[model samples]
Target: MKVVLLQDVAGHGKKGDVVNVSDGYARNVLIAKKWGLEATPKNLNDLKLRTKNEAKLAAEHLAAAREMAEAMKSWKVETAIKTGENGKVFGSVSSREIADEVKKQYDQDLDKKKIILEEPIRSLGMHEIKVKLHPQVTAILRVHVGEA
Candidate 1:
């Protein structure tokens, strides 16, 4: 049976790809879950239109990500964490705290999942953090950790 995938299917094909699948897969799995539709003449045409619309939306999203990346490139966020006399933080800073601070400062609500820290900030110093805007769009941000 032939089907048009509505989303990426592992080991088979990606969204918008028309593929020949087993009858069981088409009837029991894909169709039942609304992950795909049977490839009829009208369905294929509709899938093409849907795919085109999705591509346009994806391009727009990519453009917006790029713009946000450029803006974030100039960002340097300062954080004050309680530290000891030896300059070690009592508690390490997490990505959620930094994401919240970013939102507080710039009014940009970034996903905590998109922030990447190689290691927790445990000392008072300047550091660099990476923000994953998209699979390809990334920005390095400057962070200054001060003792509070």
Candidate 2:
């Protein structure tokens, strides 16, 4: 029996995949558990249409990511820190702080996790930060740290 998987089946097939299984297993396990559907002509055609739509949406998301990356290259964020007489910062700046500052100052929301900081900022100066916007897109942002 030919079956179209609705979701991934361990050691079997992935979602939207067509595979041949024994008639008894297809009727008893796959269909009974709603893991897959019979690969009728209508179901096959629907799968093709869904795949096409998914590809289009993925392309649109990539384009948006690229645009955001370009915009970020020209943007700069400023953060304030408390310092002692010797100019040593009290606490290091975190990615969460940078993300919040960007949102508050630039009116754009950015994920803290996406703000890749190899090490927390401990000294006051201009720093470059890398932001992973997407799998294929990365942006470098300038950050200025000043005493408060």
Q: Which has the greatest lDDT?
A: 2
For candidate 1, the 10 contiguous residues with the lowest summed lDDT are 83-92
Location of the lowest summed lDDT over 10 successive residues in candidate 2: 67-76
lDDT of 2 by residue, 17-134 (tens): 9999999999999999999999999989999999999999999989998998999888889999999998878999999999999999889989999999989999899999999988
The per-residue C-alpha lDDT of model 1 at residue 104 equals: 84
Off by over 4 Å in 2: none
Clash pairs detected, candidate 2: none
User: In candidate 1, which residue ranges exceed 4 Å CA deviation?
Assistant: 7-14, 20-35
True-vs-predicted CA distance for residue 82, candidate 1, Å: 0.7
- Residue 21, model 1: Cα distance from true site in angstroms: 6.1
Over the stretch 38-135, how does candidate 1's per-residue lDDT look in tens digits?
Answer: 99999999987887898899999899999998998788888889977766579988888899889888899899899898777887788889999988
**In order, what lDDT does every prediction score?**
0.88, 0.93
Query: TM-score of model 2 relative to the true fold?
Result: 0.90
Q: How accurate is candidate 1 locally (lDDT)?
A: 0.88
